[model samples]
Target: MRKYSRKKKEIAVEDYVSGIKSGDRTMLARAITLVESHTNRHFTVAQQVIEQLGSVKTNSIRIGITGVPGAGKSTFIDSFGTYLCELGYRVAVLAVDPSSEVSKGSILGDKTRMERLSNNPRAFIRPSPSSGTLGGVNRKTRETIFLCEAAGFDIILIETVGVGQGEFVVRSMVDFFLLLVLTGAGDELQTMKKGIMELPDLVVVNKADGDNVSKAKQAMREYNTILHFLRPYTEGWTTKAVTASALEETGLIEIYKEIEQFIHMTRNNGIFEKRRTEQLKEWFDSSLKDKLYAQFFYDEKMKESLLQYEKLIIDGEKTVGNSVNELISLFLNKKE
Candidate 1:
């Protein structure tokens, strides 16, 4: 019997760029993997690929979807994404799954739940692990979105891991933010994160079919009343609540229309361009901090010093504030 080597072939940076630009899904997926990787080699290659691609500025929309657990988010995305594909838009769903703290393992099972959209030719669904970054959102999600857009995805849907601070983080990146909710508004509102109510541009009361129709409508009304009192996240836009049934595929068109109207209004008011500029600046600042953090923590000397400092602190030989100052000075001196 002949033994076969199982090593995977490494793609060239040029190939990655060309493949992504030409809308090759395989290359796009691989490029996203490169960006998501923690290794130094992968980071260099990923940055080269991204820089080569440049700022695409494609005619695209980034929509952030977040909701409470059991709010039927996957179901809604499946229905809504398929609907968008039918309207001749290539949809890309980036579903961020929460990772286990101990094992750092993620289920990444959004594809399984979004059966229809997963199978659709015009739709692409990528499930990413939060990997303990950005509050249950994939750290490389912004880069992933750029790659997807270069691959001709006109509609990008970022589905965050439930409702939490992750929604706030995702809101900063997307053009529109949508909140999905179920009946029992009063109880849910009480349990939600403190500033979450002020984040969404639109709130949908889902599962509005058969027995739940009346309850969903009541919930919608309650949400609308609450929303009426709060300021809208976007200027000159009214954030309202509507009822929808993912199972029945009802009210999806209305949701789409609302989004369409929003994009139009924002563009006319110049708020769209302004927001994108601010987002790009924020991304730069965030990337710089991440790079500095990696450099300091991953440095051999720094790691050794950290261990010594940690031990000293645990032994009550060094104060935390003093240790931190010393570490920073040491790191800067090493760089010098």
Candidate 2:
């Protein structure tokens, strides 16, 4: 006879707090899982954990890294993060993986890609599924950042799922935004989104090694020329382009120094503090919207009405705008 193992006991809120405070990796991972849960029971526990640990503040900086496909984002992070670790900084990488549409499962292969950093004691890499969220980011990413900060990681790196409108979303939540590009800027820029070029705090022409060094430098020069004409995303700062080779692990220090300078300038000028407050407000507003949407859609009466309205709209019996208005009115009336 095959016997199934019994369910493990649920961890208490205090245990989660204590484990995270003491830097227990397992506990930190579990806490993040709880935060990512969509179930009501888990949501209640997660909220309680976040509320109790709200005072766990640290001098942490969240840097978002995004690039076009095949831009070596994971490779670059592996090198850059290892460098930060060597410099005595505890680094946390939140790698957002795209979910499979059919199965809704993520490969979560960041640890495999960033082998060196994954094995480093000072580095913590958490791979989360985007779960079809707008911007290809995990819905609970901001909350995950809070948990990482509470776990005493001073350097938080967010690797977005490719580059697109996700750049704007990541930029809003992060203190710094980095864009990576390959050689041949002339060709790449044509295909790149105009809005994306304006978002990066720094642009790096990666893969600058071997026979590609000259091309990489030329690309960097071209990027710098383009950046010169565009307004920098951060006020009181000039965004520039540099070259780096993740494979050879060269030019990492330059990137680190550039980020350090940006952080210093932002902090001194009060932009850093102001941005953090804005991020909190945005998180609150977004969460409120999410809860309201869930409440309306999950209501049994609303569900029945929604199905009827959907059928009518699909069959062209009712106008979409009118159906939407009726649905909103119904939801509001139900609340009353």
Candidate 3:
């Protein structure tokens, strides 16, 4: 694997662009890794290659699917993603997994869960490590989406573990955000948080095909009533509550139809374009922070000074406010 990756990296930027455009999954995976790399050399090469390929110039439907653990998220993706492929659409599943503490690498277990989608030629599945980012998504996810679009994937599904409040970043990045809920968890009114209720483009109750059907319907009804009282996530459209059963493949079509209707309505009203623009702006701002932090954090002098101030705080020799001011002064006084 290491030799193959090294060889893939040696492929020139033009070749990388060509391979990505040709929809070669190996090349696509390697390109995504290059973008996720933190080294200066890899970063420069990735940027150059991305500029040449012009992933941002292409267009695709970006969908974010977030649900709590045990909500059958992977099963839902397998069923829904297969449905998408049957309609002759090229689909990509970017599954973000929690980072393992020891190696800081993802468990990469979603493939086992999404077996059918993984095997489907019409589908491309990539499981990425969250790398301990606050949200369950890594920073390069936006760039990956761009690459997937350029690689001929018309539909991009971003699957994230439900990190509760941390899901906002995923919400901001996608065209449609789907929140999957399971039945019999609890009373929706008591368990659902207001912020989550307002964030999803659509709230779907999964496992609706089993004996849980009645409970699922009840949850849907309860959510619809609760959602009536809150402001809509999108300006023109109210978020819809529905149910699904990934095991039986029931309601997947209905879920997709709702997704299409939302996209159509948002595109016609200009919300879709506006949302994409805002996400790019966010990416720009966040990248600025990373650049600034890299510059400051890598300086040996700054590191020593920060440690000294940190020690003072630990020993109660200085207040955190004073230490912050000292660090700010140290940073500003240094020559650019």
Q: Which candidate achieves the best TM-score against the true structure?
A: 1
Candidate 3: stretches off by over 4 Å: 1-9, 96-108, 130-138, 185-194, 295-336
Tens-digit per-residue lDDT, 1-336, candidate 1: 222454867888999999999899999999988887776667778878989999897889999998887899999999999999999999999865443334464433547899999999999888765464343134477778889998999999988755435687788889999999999999998878888989999999999999999999999999999999999999899999999999999999999999999999999999889988877887777667666777787788999999999999999999999999999999998853
Model 2 spans with C-alpha error above 4 angstroms: 1-8, 97-110, 130-139, 298-336
Error of 3 at 300 (Å): 8.9
**What are the lDDT scores of the predictions, listed in order?**
0.85, 0.84, 0.79
Span of 10 residues, lowest total lDDT, candidate 2: 130-139
| Least accurate 10 contiguous residues by lDDT in model 3 | 130-139
TM agreement with the true structure for every prediction: 0.88, 0.86, 0.82
- Model 2 score (lDDT): 0.84
| Candidate 3 lDDT, 87-174, residue by residue in tens | 9999999855433433464533548778998999999988775465333134577778888988999999988766544367678889
TM-score of 1: 0.88
The residue-level lDDT of candidate 2 at 79 comes to 93
> What are the RMSDs of all candidates, in order?
3.9, 4.2, 4.2
Relative to the true structure, candidate 2 reaches a TM of 0.86
